[model samples]
Target: MPKLETRLTRTFNLQYPILSAPMAFAAGGRLAAAVSRKGGLGIIGGGYGDPAWLEEQFALAQGVPVGVGFITWSLRKSPSMLTDVLKHRPVAVMLSFGDPRPFVDEIRAAGARIICQCQNMGHIMDAADIGADVIVAQGSEAGGHGAVRGTMTLVPEAADYIRATAPDSILVAAGGIADGRGLAAALMLGAEGVLMGTRFWASSDSLVHDGHRAALLEADGDGTIRTQVADIARQIAWPIEFTARIRQNAFTRRWHGHEDALRKEAATVGPIYRKGFAEGDAEQTGVFFGEAAGLIHSIESVDTLIEQINQQALDCLAGPATRLTSDRP
Candidate 1:
């Protein structure tokens, strides 16, 4: 099999050029550690700087070179958590949903590469300014918060800009990439690797609610919608330009385009939303996933998913002529 060798693999010292996205409340220590143990880098979701949660997940990711990702705007409020995260000496410190500039120097001093997840081309320049080792070009199709650009155009565009300005910077593609074909396509688009979230969110090791996982399996690409309904219902103060792609449910339908209405009804809706999450009520809550939800038909182990992606990429790269004719001879 061809090694998934690239700047990503070399930088993280991973066998497969994959990063298990640190999806908040979804990817915890077990999932991250599992991916890391199996040759890919695993990233714990340190969403909003929950100290106790972060501590528990870090403990669970004991043996692996686990990294941690944070929503930058949220992380700013709890800067001490960054120090706590670095104490573990992760392979990389991933930041998304806001500016990563303030944390770059501290992350480097702690001996971890900076992985800046950018939702727009403008953010890519900000990351480069901070000398980020890796820039994850996350398009609008991604499950979580993202900007308007699509992955197809944005990945290569960012790659070209980075190559011209920061030759040593590595580029990774995110958003809507879930399978082997996606991985292969990313490489061809000038990215050295991929940041996987939705696919891994349905994995066995993921901390996702069982109800959410079941619903995700039933959902296709069309089943998801990009909107701020969930954020509004849950009262998360996300950036105005970024929207989350989540599986359609009653909650989304009830408040889809009515952001103002949701806000007006926050007192009543917020409690219900929190209850739905606590109870795993699919109808009452939305499941965060991407357009790649179409590619995910079954819930499998991370090991199985990673191996499948690796094999698929190898086959795709080899082509039928090399795969079939060589075996015949």
Candidate 2:
């Protein structure tokens, strides 16, 4: 039982240096409250800015120090959505996948800390300039929409930049960190904590459908493909440069690189896709996950999972670096 104290845990008044990602549709009130109850920060996903869903989750959190997140660009479509969320006085607000400038001032004025997730140097610099309290270096290994940069390289780069520039801003690592080993490695890489999406997405408290969870359990890293296929097929208005990571099911295998084909046939395929999602057809719907899916074998409670990872990380940080260095002697 080693103490894993870092600026992040202290800054956020958390017992552990872990933060559950606000994954849209997957992370809800139960998941967020469960994580918060276990001493880790829980952020509810307000993905794509659904005011009703966001309000419902906030209420469900029931006075927990629960945070809320939004896809920055999508929130632009519904500007007042931020105000709606802000009135709740969330513990924190996370903005990702677009310019955070638009809402930075308001968030700061609201007296709540802001967490900005960035994929590249430019994005991070912008977050720093905006005075983000926590900067998450999200790699492409993360589920859902992401930018160019692997977690390994991006974490250190962001850490270095933060130290050099925004010394007060905390650095967090994201993408493919589903276990304790990854947590220890992130600490070594200069990050104060890790923002986990895929791991928490598979937790029992998560809102994942049984069918989608089945798909997630059956799949691994290779089982997912990063593409705008879902956006096109489901007719989501995502940015051209952005893409989502979803499990490779029959639907995706049928049209992996054929975006144009999916677009042309969206009229016919769209209904089926929507229906599959609605009916919980695992094969036809998108199951969002990251490369870390390969590392997750079972769905456990937030307390069990967070404690397991924390103790594992403590062991690694104290015992040896062998877990991170190599496999064979």
Candidate 3:
């Protein structure tokens, strides 16, 4: 990829205006550090506030310039874990799901940049009100949990919202952003950069199972599913308003709209789901991802993927396709 620069790179002090989303356990220290080393920001997913796992990954990072993210509600339960991690002084602290206001003071007191992943304009405003250093507009196409809004409309709306309310705050677009086209489109929508999950999940450094990665490579965008009760029934305890997006499989097909049934089957289905995770069964183990999965045909190194995406964006923007053809009488 050719050399490219954007506001996000300068504002966030990132080598590339690209970011690897905190994909729960999928994006562990190795993956996060790899992306950070490869000129992008890598945030270790402090998913559901697992202090032990967080500590283990932080150790694995070993002083790399990476940030850490947490699902806000879970962090509330384990307040001390956040305090402990902050002692290391991560580059940034990203908070998604639930209100991050209560913890913003502590995060800022540690001299860490604050990145709030917002699900809507209201959330964006709330993050700005809390004096967030940066706002990541996470549209519904994002993997794992999110609200109900497509990336195309949500990104631009969030951008416009921030531009009007907090012009100085940097905005990054998330959800279904995989290739150069996605990156360029985000910039057009008023984002300074892009935060990616599914694409990175398929990378060499990600903890995603090899078989699962292979399955994602074989699948297309249309294969993804967006559901709510699946995660709730599994006891993940995501906020009632947020939902998850994953690859559609037998499980989703059977329970997608059947929230009532999922609630009823939770007792029996939960055990099977856990078994699938241990056995690495793709049919049962959820393949968490976004629509961008269609653009990802192969699993490559983090460096290669990041470089290609940046280069592709530059090439497309410099090309003539962006110009309009007009004929006048």
Off by more than 4 A, model 2: 321-329
TM-score of each predicted structure versus truth: 0.96, 0.96, 0.94
Query: Which segments of candidate 3 are over 4 A away from where they belong?
Result: 322-329
Model 2: per-residue lDDT, tens digit, 207-230? 987777777778878888788888
Q: In model 1, state the lDDT of residue 33.
A: 97
Q: Candidate 1's residue-wise lDDT over 37-84, tens digit each?
A: 999999999987789889899899885889999999999988999998
Each model's lDDT comes to 0.88, 0.88, 0.84
Point out where model 1 deviates above 4 Å: 321-329
Which of candidates 1 and 3 is the stronger one according to TM-score? 1
Candidate 3 TM-score over all chains jointly: 0.94
Error of 3 at 29 (Å): 0.5
Tens-digit lDDT track for model 3 on 1-329?
A: 46567777887677888889988879899998999998899999988777788889988988898999988888888889889999878889999988998898899889899999999888888988887878999888787889887889988888888888888888999998888888888888989898999989999999888877887877888888878755846767667888888888877877778878788778888888877765656777577888888888888999889887877787677877743221111
How many collisions per candidate? 0, 0, 0
The worst-scoring run of ten residues by lDDT in candidate 3 lies at: 320-329
